[model samples]
Target: GLPKSMSVLRVNDLVLAAYDSGIRRLEPRNGYSPGQQDSQQFWSAGSSKCQGWDSQGDATYQVLVQEVNASAPQAEPYYMQILKTCELDDATGTVQIATRCSLNGEDVLHYRGDQNRWFSVHPAAWRVAERWNQAAEVFGAMNHLTPQQCQSWIQSSASFIAQQTAQPTGHMALVPRTEARPRRLICHVTGFYPRPIKVTWEQGEQDALWEQLSSGILPNGDHTFQIQVSIELGQEGAGPTEHVCVVRHSSLANTTLRVTWDSQPTVQTVTMEIVVGCLLTALGVGALGWYLRKK
Candidate 1:
């Protein structure tokens, strides 16, 4: 099964709702304030599910909430985080739930669902971890509720996930060389989703085996990805050769996207040639007119 995860983001004292994977699944307009009707419905559903889980055992989920509120520090500039991840081992038919907490960018506590225990990540956090572990409600939910939520969300969002992929756009350009480097042919692919993509330089029918450099896949502000692969152009090449940049991505699985680049005259070079040709033609016509006048 594919790995699944959920994250709740908080900044300072304001608590926001959770997200499935990276998509914003549920969030309120203001801190704990009622948002849209659908968002409230979703939150209510999750709360009811928690209550149902609490009914199955002696520990109530409210204990976990109260413990969290009581454990929060009163100091300013405080930060808290909770991350839950679930992974399935296909070979053993086993699922693992990993839950952890951080404070002020430092790991403070972690829960071992397999062992049914919460442990301090550092010696300084031992007291805090021990205090929180006393609330059996938290660990039980971390152990059982997380995997179920992960699986159910994945199944329900399968079609939505498939529609999320964004196809990449690619282009090729010849860049001027520096004093220490040779000219380069750069292939850039951008605005792609899912991040996993292949950008390679090819010469005619085969992969270009020349020395190349790559700007590894980088995230765009809009959540898409981009990459650039470049190969140095050597002076030893006899003539212009057609080179192509090939991009392979899940969004373009059915077709390979290619952007081609070849040696072409620069705009300045073409402009200079046209100016010189015009000047030569003017000089030749003037000379012919003078000879005809002399005749």
Candidate 2:
């Protein structure tokens, strides 16, 4: 739950969890990336009907974004939906690529490109580069934005002034994994924007340092982004006892992923053997007592 003094934000990654604050989670308005020419669209097959396996159709894309106000832990989710159309000219052997980028019926940019036959860059090529640059810019911005920044915006923004602050009402409990072989655990944080939050492992209250590895953001096709954090677990014979994944937000309370060690099957079997030995000894003594009484 959100503390009385602080605010709350209801974040959604679609991994499945309940809201901690009172804010209801609403779907976003837009998240579709601009559809550029020569860009492939991937789709999942329907249950019974036919379509080319996953990559058959021309690219038609939609973007979905779900954001929470920083001050409230459980607030209604802010929704953003981006719808894009990719128009191309295949008859003339030239690519005329145009992407109409809009948010809730509002235009952001009309990404346009033309594929030239001679030395000029193709429209598709240009559009691809442009889109990449835009995504890169967003990635850059994530580093600078924090929860506190969001809290400040909430106070002045017309959209947020009437909003209720959601509190951090719940937590994520870790599902333990046990195997003798070397295994790795990877978790991706979803429903975060500007990607400023930092993820790390902690033992109780203190910082637990593991090997520092690579971390980055990947597009989920729906304008929203997923941040992936990976860690190697338990070396040979040195089992890890406890670890937690902490997500630090600027304005909202931090989220913790708590995990405990799984019980070893081998240990359980050894304990069972000891119990069986004790039972056998007891039975033998009972038989001896009965025989002596009969004599």
TM-score (all chains, Cα) for each model: 0.55, 0.29
RMSD of 2: 24.7
lDDT string, candidate 2, 1-295, tens digits: 4311111122222111122112322111232211232212211111111122111111212211111122223344332222222222336433333333222332333433343111113222334335544562422211222334334322223232222222211122222355643444444354444334566666555775555343454333332344445456544433345555566543254544443334423434534543453354455334323221222
Q: Candidate 1, after superposition: displacement of residue 278 in Å? A: 44
What is the lDDT of every predicted structure here? 0.57, 0.33
> Any idea how many clashes model 2 has?
43
Q: What lDDT tens digits, residue by residue, belong to model 1 across residues 161-213?
A: 45567899865656666899887776767778777888887776788777889
Compare the candidates by TM-score and give the number of the best one: 1
Candidate 1: stretches off by over 4 Å: 1-40, 46-78, 89-93, 103-112, 115-123, 126-145, 173-175, 179-183, 234-241, 262-295
Global Cα lDDT for candidate 1: 0.57
Identify the leading candidate in terms of lDDT.
1
- Span of ten consecutive residues with least summed lDDT in model 1: 286-295
